[model samples]
Structures are given as C-alpha cells and as structure tokens.
Target: MSARPTTEAERLRRCRQVFELAVRDRVSMAVARDRLARERWAEADARLSAKNNTALCGTAAPAFAETDEDGDARLQWWQR
Candidate 1:
C-alpha cells in the first residue's frame, strides 16, 4: 500500500488485497482455494529446490591429450 499499515484495520485491508491476487491469478481456484494454494506452493518449492541443487551444475569439458610426433594414436578426439 502507498501508505503504511499503521492500524490493525489497515493491515487487514492490505492482507486481504494480497490474498485477492492469488484468487485473481487462479492460484486459489473458486471451488478449491486451499488445495490450489498447496499445489502452487509445492510448484514454487520444487523450482527453488532445483535451482539450489549441486547436481544441476554443468559438467566440465575434458582436456585434449598430448600425443607423440607420430600422431598415429591421435589426440583426444576418439577418447570417451
């Protein structure tokens, strides 16, 4: 709110407005507000969990192997 919620009435009014946004966005469905809220929370939690996980890091590139003058064995091109 432009003005701070200095009174309990003002605080409640702002709180209700915030809750109304969820209904407007369909995060709280008309017939199942509580269930929809849970689903919405679960989805947000899952995305946050994935974003913070160590396993999501990209793998490093392998270094090319040194070869002799013969060049018969090839560099690291054929290596796994």
Candidate 2:
C-alpha cells in the first residue's frame, strides 16, 4: 500500500478522490458510518468515564493547563 498522505492539502485531495469514487459507485453506506461513529463514541465515552474520572478540562485539554507542570513540560523544547 502507498504511504499515507502527510500534508493537509494531500489529505483533502485524497478525501475528494474517495468522495468522487463513492459518488460514482453510488455507495452511500450510512449505516456503516453510523455504526462506526457509535462505536467510536462509545469507546471515547468509556475512556472518559472510566474510574469516574471525567474531568477533561485538565487531563485532555492542554491549552487550559498553561499553569500545570505537564503543560510547562513543553517549555523544555522551546528552551532548547
């Protein structure tokens, strides 16, 4: 298989190509898409709900963790 597209432009171009092919084939697999989305959401929800630890503002989002030690860890790269 070919390597995955690395750039945003290349990824969008690939998506357009896939969309065109799907349209030409009249392949509207909405059920599969819905199922996949549901499964993904369930998995994400499970991860977030596990151990009753759902506070994502501090654990998942780093931008809001500017004063956190973990957030300041990126400063090492900037300093280097």
Clashes of each: 0, 0
Candidate 2 structure, TM-score to reference: 0.33
Instruction: Give RMSD to native, each candidate.
Output: 10.7, 17.1
User: What is the alpha-carbon lDDT of model 1 when measured against the actual structure?
Assistant: 0.63
Model 2, residue pairs in steric clash: none
lDDT of 1 by residue, 1-80 (tens): 33553888866765676577666776653435565557769997898687445555665446799957756466455563
Which residue pairs in candidate 1 have backbone atoms (N, alpha carbon, C) closer than 3 angstroms, thus clashing?
Answer: none
| Candidate 2 accuracy as lDDT | 0.64
* Candidate 2: regions farther than 4 A off: 1-28, 52-80
lDDT leader: 2
- lDDT (0 to 1) per candidate: 0.63, 0.64
